[model samples]
Target chain A: MADLLRLDRDPAAALRETAQRAAVRDWTCATLGLGESATVLVTELSCAEPGCPPREVVIAVFAPHAPRRQCRIHCALAELDESRVRAAWLAPTPCGGSHD
Target chain B: MTDTNDKVPVTVLTGFLGAGKTTLLNRILTENHGQRIAVIENEFGEIGVDQELVINAEEEIFEMNNGCICCTVRGDLIRILGSLMKRRDRFDRIVVETTGMANPGPVAQTFFVDDDMRERFALDGIVTLVDARHFGQQVDANEEAREQVAFADVIVLNKTDLVTATELEAVERRVRAMNALARIVRSDPAARAAVPVDSVLGIGGFDLSRALEYKPTFLEPEYPFEWAGRFDLAAGRHELVLGEGPDPDMGLALFPAPPVEAEDPARVAAERAFKWFAEDVEANAPGTLLRPAESLAILDLQGTGSKRFPVQVDAPGRYWLVTQHLPEEFALALHDPQGRPVRPGLERAFAAGHTHDDEVGSISLETEEPLDPRRFSDWLSRELQAQGASIYRMKGFLNFKGVDQRVVIQGVHMLTDNTTLGPWGEKPRRTQLVFIGRNLDTQALIDGFDACLAD
Candidate 1:
């Protein structure tokens, strides 16, 4: 969890992070509209809960002087979709959750 | 120690002509960020190179080679990357610009499909830029455009400023319908601003990490010939028949099956009988057996490719019917044409394998024994020279006598690239090679490889 933002863990880890970020950025731009003041960051997290899948891609969007909004798609990078991304984006950001 | 992140990331950018790939490329290059990026653009048509720092790539974008990346220009890609590796600190990332009409399947597949490509390059993602103004018409009129969208991890709907908000939504919807999973972006290419360069360039989506689950066919067994099954047959007159398909080019032969009992007296007699039959067939005419036929191994067997053999068994023993390079699985009947039981109540065992399309397939040879490097080089050169056109790709890791490092061999058509992979790590050494091609002969390849084995 501490090194989740690190892209150098392995080839596969880098792939997961890069792919998730690209997808999240695309979804954010398409849904929230592209502007000069908007910045989007996508992060993939490993779920360590019992019976949960190993990882999920989370998206956080920040705009000019606004509170950060975070959302997550509980699936692999290849399975990320607009519907899922939008659902996660609309969901409230968890309190005290770390952002990469 | 080489870290996995040390491998350079390559982003394959694809889109139809006028898809704003150039706009996006220019934006990434000129941005204030201090990262060094190398751009490889496959020049097409009348379009001049837009990026000042661009590496020109050949425009010959070929079709998929053996369900993977195109090998036609793979050599060029390999050579370019090889040179790039020599000066490691120059570029932080690589962006490959494919022709608008090009299919992204092969380009993305190259990352994990080829050992060398996988070793040097980690695919970041496939970014397909789409012109929002004419995307609806282009997707409907062209299959290549549809394919580009289908394979993209990031779909940049460029020129969004030209389209109305409603049209923008419709274009996004159409792209989603074609590829439900791709990330979609509406790009206002007119805005001299950076178009989310950070999100697209370093994204690790192209890692082929989940390839096994997403595309199981990549792991599907690929071989020119499949060994069916070994059947236990009692010594007797029998006929071998093709089962369940149009006959393919095949070679069938019978070998003396081992005896059940180690000290059995019948085993010695059976070996002598087989030796007698071999001498008789070589000296006499085709399908001829010795005068004392009851003691002969086989009564008469001749011809190739789905022909019946009149086989005789002098003793109560076992035998094997080996089938080579054929679509049809062979089954041995206990009784002859008369329908009497040669061995009662024994069912035929068929090989558990299936056939693929006729155009391309693979042949793999794996052995624990070390190979003579010179002999293998000669055999491979001869094979590739005679049938290189039909042979699309060949790759293998081999053990060479007196060499400590693992020898890696890879080739597409006639062109080949060879190098040593440091050392054999903490694993047993073995030789494994696979050739994907058309019209493959398993026996010939097996014989050739056997000749390369160290004596």
Candidate 2:
């Protein structure tokens, strides 16, 4: 019963990654009130810093009439939740303003 | 006597890496073409190595710093080309070999936009060499590859031997899809001596007559800025106080009018003083009351609660401010700090429903009615001086009242080249223009051009 399903070779990981990205995109669009024309890119980025963790989910938003906005969640794509995304999206910019 | 001071034609060579550009260039150099060619070699590497690859011939070779010729190295090309022009023994023709991943748009635009570049050098054509083996992958992966083909007058389909007949046909189809007008020259990779030197060089692909008809793709860019406003006011000191935007660092470029020169000596003296203020503002120098050129005095607003700054206007004219966000987001106010409102709460200069692409966008206007030459010139001069930095490239064929020939106006930033193309020749007398830039107002530009039409 232990090795019956072979979870290690699960192809659903790729499918889950895609679905998670779509969910993240949908959530971002809904939260930001972005139009269909707006472009959203979600990726896993690695940072080599003392305080910064190795792997993180990075969300990039490009909407017309506004500057490009990028936010980083300190988690993997599969581990991303709506509350976590909301927190990251609402995080203050480097200049002390809300993320555009 | 031959005019030795005549403008030398510049042919820009562009393509992806390992695309037989060096082969084509070497062929041109070694060939007894009787033309003294000055080659400007631009490579994208830490150390410039492509210059060493060039075959030693009786030609002038200038190596540009390692960077994309389109962006960082563009200024280098202009400066080097300018220096080359000042020489006593000038080359008959100039050739610029841009890095593989280079957009030829800015390079081709240098000739059209720079005053000295236009007077001293003319853009002959952009000849792109396509590596037939990797054409599909390169075109798919690289925007530069696609642009090189799109902007080319000549496309050398090099390394034909590496690909099969079917593959070659597919590559040709893809190349044609990108640019139907470019003359595609097929060259074998094995045959180095058989390079199409004759077909590539001296081809006037950058014909201004045909360039006026804007390419649709050239206009497609998502502009960072969206809305813009143009304000006309009497000569006085004014203040533009910014409110807020989605981004804390909201940027707005204000273009104040250049001082108008009047015949009166008093007016001339006043104009000089006003111009000094404009210069100081543009330079971000402290103590200048008005700074039209700066972004509403962002540098001055450091650690300040209020975002208001004073600007001096010497002459009565129009001052335009193009903002990165919508007018509401950044309620940038233009008013006299001391005097009353000119329009009485009409602080919003001209709130346009301006929607452009996310990057670089374009706006074009075509009118059948002939425009008054003086009015058109004045409008263009003011427009360029104000918003030239954001406006990347502008070219148009103008139909004027008295002029027998059609006037072709080409500009890059503030630099413009206006030349008369001989006669309408039974064709439609139309004024057509295309402006490619970041956050341009299409309706505003169209309205401005329409105003130039004679009553």
Candidate 3:
């Protein structure tokens, strides 16, 4: 929680996080073999579920006519690495059907 | 890394078919608002006619994966907004024009659900246009129409000249019933969808605090509680008895009712109670005593078929009670110390429900081959003339034979517009087109594009 609040108090921290997220998104796309048309969303959400980390990064992949795929990393966006992303993608969890 | 105050303001424009959304959009672009505005439109048909109607701005159209009706976020909006924030200096604000049949839920939800969007862009408001004469039928016939009215921060009743004053009053009544919170402004009939720029732009309709400041009774339908009751109480301990219900615990808030002279007293108290219920919860086990304070308290109703909690009232005055669910659902009742029922003097139910349009959908067409300009134009004209009624919105980039620049095209029904958007340069030239509407023939559209390919 303090780390997330630092993003609001420090401009440098926010910029660093934004850059890191963009890099992670690019790496995820490359590792997952997703095209430009596919929409890749990387979000850092606070986990309320017991036994889960305080904060985690959720990466969701959406493409036309394909089932939505996502993976959760038990770490903050800054702590995420390419190896972790690849590992998550390899054992990706199927997301719920439709946002409706 | 801009501060929250410096984030760009975005306004979402939505309405039913033939509601003068494009006319209002043109007025916004032509007006001297002193702000450079970038417009993103999701037209129903494949030709970009709305883009041509817009002046002094380049059209950027992105398609979302709407094949699954349950997809929550508008993928196209997320992609376009992400790119727009990168070149934030180019535009002062952004206005998104959704297709007429759009639900506007996914469009508005995109701002809050996406982390990057939430940080960089603030949803200024959702402005909906209503065709004064046809709104009544539209609202009754289409769920999308009703949802647009329900979710608007500002409702612009356009085409007033076409309807009589009596008929207009009836329509306004219907709009008000659908959304009591929205500020309804009648458009200038002589000017055609003309509205005061300030009424729509720069309004913090989405800002909850600002909304509450503007209207003390500002309550969104998505709140947890649905009903609020005002009761006249004496200075003593009252008992709140609850029967078996769904949840293990129930959230409750008790606050001083607003003065009788206050405007919309019921809503004012409801809004205040809503704030209290959102605060940190203080849980009380069954048979425990709870003091009525300006905060939230939870009653643990588990393990007992019926639980009783004492509510202490400090002073004899009017107090409001807000429960997480309707009291009837839990068979909840309040009693005076003597065991007599303490009935509420007033009760108000907040509107709560969500609906989506399942009939409307989008089709995407893509080809690597460049098109013959003359042949493509003739085919498009013929298609719009024949099937424009069914085709709601169409937009995409076209790669023309012997033309270096990329041609942008968009259309709504019979209206179509196109412009050459500089040379493709080193990028690959591929024609991508998308049509959003009802009852579209996928094979026919694909074959039509194939026929327009250069030999």
Whole-model Cα lDDT per candidate? 0.56, 0.59, 0.70
Cα distance off (Å), candidate 3, residue B334: 47
Cα TM-score per model: 0.37, 0.42, 0.46
Better of 2 and 3 by lDDT: 3
Give stretches of model 2 more than 4 Å off: A1-100, B1-5, B43-75, B82-90, B109-114, B162-184, B188-198, B209-396, B411-415, B425-455
List interface RMSDs for the candidates, in order.
Answer: 20.4, 29.3, 19.1
**Candidate 2's interface RMSD, please?**
29.3
Candidate 1 ranges with C-alpha deviation above 4 Å: A1-100, B1-3, B44-53, B61-73, B189-194, B207-455
Q: Per-residue lDDT of B1-455 in model 1, one digit per residue for the tens?
A: 11246788898888998887776777787776777888777864323444434667664332222221333233235445655666677788888888887765446544543334555777677888888889878877886787677667678888878886656755765565454335676665467223678667776443222221232223223222222223455545554443323233243344554555346323233333333333333222233332223222222223344334445555544544433322223333434535553442221212213443233345667888998776787788777667765554465677877677776665545555555667887767888776655566767888999998987
- Pick the winner on TM-score between candidates 2 and 3: 3
For model 2, residues B351-433, the per-residue Cα lDDT tens digits are 12234223344465778898877677777766765665556556677787776787676555555555566789998898877
Q: Over the full model, what C-alpha lDDT does candidate 3 score relative to the true structure?
A: 0.70
lDDT (Cα, tens digit) per residue for candidate 3, span B229-269: 88999889899999987678888888787566477676787
In model 1, what lDDT does residue B205 have? 48
Task: Arrange candidates, best TM-score first.
Answer: 3, 2, 1
Cα deviation of A67 in candidate 1 (Å)? 58
Who wins the TM-score comparison? 3
Error of 2 at B321 (Å): 56
